[model samples]
Target: MFTIQQIDGAHAKVKTGADFPKYIQEIKELGVTAFDFLVSNGVEVYYGEEPFKTNSPAKYDPLNINENLNAQQFAKELKEHQDGKTDFPYFVKMCAINGIASWKVDLEEYTCTYFDLEGEEVLQEEIPGE
Candidate 1:
């Protein structure tokens, strides 16, 4: 799962040294890999990974960003992962219920949904790291 909360810290750190697009790309890569590891180990995961477009005064070129490709592609690719293999979010939640930290998940795919163990739906406002 991807938490805007946790990512906020990482994002802030990345922004100081990297362009917004590069920072987002790196975060998505790391976040997906972390989720995959947790899934493989049977651990439940929960987080959001939706990508967004913004005008960054911090960037050297305000128009250099492309939201059409990055955010949409990431979301689409992740959905493809869950299409037939296994329910990514469910897999993570199961691990969490058992107190596991990771499970085997298909690294070939990625998504923005999070795993929930308590059977309670998580809202953007409810993420723990925030």
Candidate 2:
């Protein structure tokens, strides 16, 4: 099961277990695009420091899975992307299809966080000078 919360006026957050694909399909059934739904639902951002560039091929790659692919197939594809076995272009397409704009994995906590398009965290190192 999955839970969705509104983060703010323009964002929403989602929490789920291993059944992320089911929740994604649910969101799609709500008449909202997966990207918009995930973004509005506040999916956690991953690799915030190195945001996907607007002109990157990955940003525009199309999802190529078979139309008849099942939830398991979706999950498998997403897992492969998460494992870094896929290229950025493929990852981008996967993200678009899955509505996972940003994500972060916490090894210590054994948790994953997903954020919306606007939820990406900007990393800033503190400087000595004020």
Candidate 3:
């Protein structure tokens, strides 16, 4: 089992999306099997083995998530963020504005999935890592 402090310490190294893959790798090594991030307030729920779970407190003020899903625009913003053109907070705010309610990353599958306001999967991408 891992604590939120440990996870947050690893996450603090992620200044931009370009740093995400490495962050995931570090946390994965910390026993985080999966994690879900709520876009509105930045709370995260981290999971490990059976019965191992921890929740992170909200990091930012709540933002209104747009009801309309703008997949195309979201994709564009995602690309820019992945390129390190924007910071993490900006990327999160953009996700909310584009109607993303949350996102989940599965360490075992090495996949990251974004969800819409209605909890529908908006996009799923393989995480690039060693």
Candidate 4:
């Protein structure tokens, strides 16, 4: 179960669940007001000043995992891994499949915080804030 709130005229808050397909349909009808979407889909949202770096191979990546590994084998592998490791990549892959290319990080305190590919905080001294 996920909750969705239409905050402003440009953005909408989206959570993840079985209701996502429905939520997206609603948001499309209602019109999103916020830029970031304030997505809290029970998945740890990563923040960066710029867009996420997507690989070319990942761009045309097939959604059907059975092509590489059978469904049962994929399920077994996923069950063995810990949380937050494979989950994010899986979510990214799903987003990509749906043509959701870029995502922005909306931090209340630091609106323009920069993060490296490894998701580490980077401070710029010449940026006036630092």
Leading candidate by lDDT: 3
Whichever of 1 and 2 has more lDDT, that candidate is 2
Which parts of model 2 have CA positions greater than 4 angstroms off? 1-73, 82-85, 115-130
Per-residue accuracy of model 1 over 1-109 as CA lDDT, tens digit each: 4454555555565422113334345555655442323333322232334442222122121111121223333334334433434344443333344333222222224
Question: 47 in model 4: Cα distance from truth in Å?
Answer: 9.1
Residue-wise C-alpha lDDT for candidate 3, range 1-130, written one tens digit per residue: 6899999899889999999999999999999999999999999999999889889888988999999999999999999999999999899999999999999999999999999989999999999995
Cα lDDT listed for each candidate: 0.34, 0.36, 0.95, 0.31
Models ranked on lDDT: 3, 2, 1, 4
Candidate 1's TM-score reads: 0.21
Per-residue lDDT of model 4, residues 24-78, tens digit only = 3443344322123111222223322345321111223333311222334333433
Residue 32 miss distance in model 4 (angstroms):
25
Per-model TM-score, in order, reads 0.21, 0.29, 0.98, 0.22
- The candidates, ranked best first by TM-score, are 3, 2, 4, 1
**Candidate 3 regions with alpha-carbon error over 4 angstroms:** none
Q: RMSD of candidate 3 to the true fold? A: 0.6
C-alpha positional error of residue 111 in candidate 1 after TM-score superposition, expressed in Å: 16
Tens-digit lDDT string for candidate 2 (1-130) = 1123221211222232333343444433333222322222233322212232111113232333223323444467756754546754455456555444555433223334544345643221121111
